[model samples]
Target: GRPPEGMWLPETAVDLETLDIMAELGIKFTILAPRQAHKVRKIGQKSWQDVSDGRIDPTTPYRLNLASGRTITLFFYDGPISRALAFEDLLERGENLVARLMSAFSEDRTWPQPVHVATDGETYGHHHSHGDMALAWSFP
Candidate 1:
């Protein structure tokens, strides 16, 4: 009922050309792996802080000014937590999953922070035994 707003690239793959295409198509945002973010900086600022170590603040969405003069927002999901959920034994207990998700936020910050976990679709019912049950328990 509405115009498209976002696009998810296969394998989370991304490049400037793809980004420009998305922007031209009026796509507002996309999710990306934290490692894909090379640098970041405050809006309207000149300096960029390198995220080569893969440590990025997942709380805020960053604006990418593309070469086409169109902008797109990027959200970098938490890599380690996503990996733990998909590969580690996190789904063995729903409580463990909840705890890990909670730890991603900051307690003192007045503003809200996002805990984005991007993982394979098979992670729900195939990757770990009873993972779908664990996910349901975590939410409820």
Candidate 2:
């Protein structure tokens, strides 16, 4: 399901009507690229204001509530970290990447919930050579 008002598609190509559509369909939330916010003057300014107010902190997740009382959670990805793993040669070593990720979450002792990594699925065969092998070996 798509998110209401604030849900931004990656490309940010949709229009305001899309929000109406999402609201009609009961979509909760979605993520968008930074550039997407710049398209609409009003919305874009508000987004920037939120960022300035620490409401859009990149290091932590935030929650947005719609007028209908539906809630949507938003997580601004760490662009540098995600880009490093996506494009840097060092990430080819799955062990190194896994260690970094594990370290990032190690402070949390509430165990049992698995850590899920999200990335473009095509990265396995199309972007990085031996990417599939790297993941297979690292995950058991």
Candidate 3:
């Protein structure tokens, strides 16, 4: 198995035990689909609030506590945009692909978080031919 940096689950499936495993293994964080999050409340809030359009704030880190009091962070990926990039097959051209990805986060929010776009390695060639080339060409 790879060193415990992070983990990706199939279909983003997870449960308490899985998160506990992540915490025990020293995994720093994991990505989840936006909808997977029931709701989120600030560290001290009494009630969980709905994220915009049910999408979790990707910019902030969410902490989950295990039964043993260990914690793991969850980073919700931008689900709608990710779906567009994947099923939509919008990476026909590398440069445009970058622009499209960037376009998802226009008009700064009060809180800015890292933008994460995850694609399986197989997506580069097996899923879509030339995906690798498009990714490389997008950079200046």
Candidate 4:
């Protein structure tokens, strides 16, 4: 079978060497938290914009330059939204879950966007109490 888009690394697990190796292995993209993203700039821009201290726009994929001049695209997930669901009881109900997910794309996005949200595996059922039911209901 062919490989999917990319792979994910645990929190702060991917460093320069890891990315260099991944690119050598033919990986093209990955998802990281906003904090992991040091800075970003639109394509063809000369300056790097600093957004790592706060939430980054998850709508666009950003490029990272490796030491050898190779690059890999990185998608930063919605940090504030992820935090809400993880610690602030945002997933206590199906409606809350749906609302949180929808708010990310409520704007008029002209280009295709991937609203990626990352969370701990326990978020599905163990941490929030009957969370799987909420997910099932929200999607079903």
Across 17-124, the per-residue lDDT of candidate 2 in tens digits comes to: 554456557655555433333222223245434343222324344455446555554445444445555777535887876775565454454544223234576677
**What does candidate 1's lDDT look like per residue over 1-140, in tens digits?**
99999988877998999999999989999989988988999877899899978898888888998887999999989999999998898899999999999999888766779889888888988988789999999998
Off by over 4 Å in 3: 1-3, 51-53, 110-112
Q: Which candidate gets the maximum lDDT versus the true structure?
A: 1
Please give the lDDT score at residue 92 for candidate 4: 80
Candidate 1 regions off by >4 Å?
none
lDDT of 4 at 106: 48
lDDT of 4 by residue, 47-86 (tens): 9888869557888888888998888888888988888878
Q: Candidates sorted by lDDT, descending order?
A: 1, 4, 3, 2
RMSD per candidate (Å) reads 1.3, 7.2, 2.7, 1.7
Where does candidate 2 clash, by residue pair?
Answer: none
lDDT for position 74 in model 3: 91
For every model shown, the clashing-pair count is: 0, 0, 1, 0
Q: Order candidates by TM-score, high to low.
A: 1, 4, 3, 2
For candidate 1, the lDDT comes to: 0.90
Residue 127, candidate 1: alpha-carbon lDDT:
83
- Tens digit of lDDT per residue, candidate 3, span 1-140? 76868899887899989899888988989988777787788888899787656567765779986798999999888776676667666667886687777876747666675776666677776787887788778765
- For candidate 4, the 10 contiguous residues with the lowest summed lDDT are 4-13
Model 3 earns a TM-score of 0.82
